[model samples]
Target: MELLRSLAAALAVGVLIGIERGWRQREAADGSRVSGLRTFGLLGLAGGLASHMPESLAAVIGLAVTASLVLGYRSEQARTASLSITNTLVGIITFALGYMAGQGLVSETLAVAAVTTLILTLRQQSHAMLKGMSHKEVESIATVDYR
Candidate 1:
């Protein structure tokens, strides 16, 4: 079925991102992460299912997902005292990617997922490159408005 395919694509997106996240946090304790492979997969599926609903209902589901992600981040922040929000941001993005899959843009969705996963995988390389760059260069990059 079409819905099944979309959900499967969504799961694939989540699993792709989740692989990176899981590997990144491999050194951390077993269950301390805000989200890892399983949670992201479920979130992806949830997004796909939500997308099948009415517009207003989908919006409500999105809100619930956002709220849950924020709360999970908050809890993990309290435990780890980590100010970094990269994982939370990625989780949110994974949801959006799922929504894209649900929209039947399978090829485009996979492309975006690949790009996002590449970015996620390049964190260390990105930071290392920044070390050689001047402040203005970094500032310009940081301040550039894509909009």
Candidate 2:
């Protein structure tokens, strides 16, 4: 039915992003990565399902999701001694896209999902670009002073 299709799209979105995350963290030991394929997949499904619930219930579910993501990130920071929020942000975005798809904005959801995955895939290139830049160059770029 229509709900099934929406949920399927949501799952697909999650899998798409999960592919990038899983591949990027393939070398990390189990439980080390902030989230892998299964976690993202569940998040996407949760988004779709939450979209179908009553507005109040949906809001509560969203809050729960956000809280869980924040807590997970804090736990990860403790274990890794790093403070990156990229994975958490990506997870939230994926959930949003799934919700959009559930709300019948399929094309827009897919488009943004593609862009999201592209950004996630570019992490190495982004880091390399910054690492290759001089401090002055970075400051100039940050300040929008092309001169």
Candidate 3:
């Protein structure tokens, strides 16, 4: 029963985050370079599966996911990407941890899910704010000028 509960919570969290990502992907004008709803959902599910497995295996799975995210980010950076896609990946891992902490059968995972969803949902607004800033303003903050 406890295991079932944890799985449900994890699944719910994954789905919630996935929905937000999906919405953002659909609305994005320039389109996102990151994996969206389905990918996020699967990642969360995989995390949950890892968490339920033996400790060593779970650690391996987590490490693999982290490594993949790092490699993906590095690849994107090499291509001069703007938005960081790793946030979704991080959210999935964190959500899995939260589910594990919640022990799979409580509202605690919901709270975690809410926070993750909020971040994913607000990404566009955050990007817009960054985009709206002037190069001079950024340079002033950084105390360095390109020119």
The TM-score values for the models, in the order shown, are 0.90, 0.88, 0.67
lDDT of 3 at 131: 93
TM-score of 1: 0.90
Q: Write the per-residue lDDT of candidate 3 for residues 1-147, one digit (tens) a residue.
A: 777667666666677777776666676555443656666666666766777778898878777777776777777677766476655366546546543633554476677678767876777799999999999988898996569
Model 3 TM-score (2 dp): 0.67
Which residue pairs overlap in candidate 2's backbone? none
| Error at 74, model 2, angstroms | 0.5
lDDT of 1 at 103: 90
> Which ten contiguous residues of candidate 2 have the minimum total lDDT?
29-38
Q: Cα lDDT of all candidates, in order?
A: 0.86, 0.85, 0.67
**Tens-digit per-residue lDDT, 38-73, candidate 1:** 878877777788789898998998898889889988
Q: Say which candidate scores most in TM-score.
A: 1
lDDT at position 138, candidate 1 = 78
Considering every candidate listed, which one attains the maximal lDDT? 1
| Evaluation by lDDT, superior candidate among 2 and 3 | 2
Q: Arrange candidates by lDDT, highest first: which order?
A: 1, 2, 3
lDDT of 1 at 25: 84
lDDT of 2 by residue, 1-147 (tens): 889989988888888898888888999887666777888888888888888989899889888888899898889888877888988888888888778878877778778889988988888899999789998997887899556
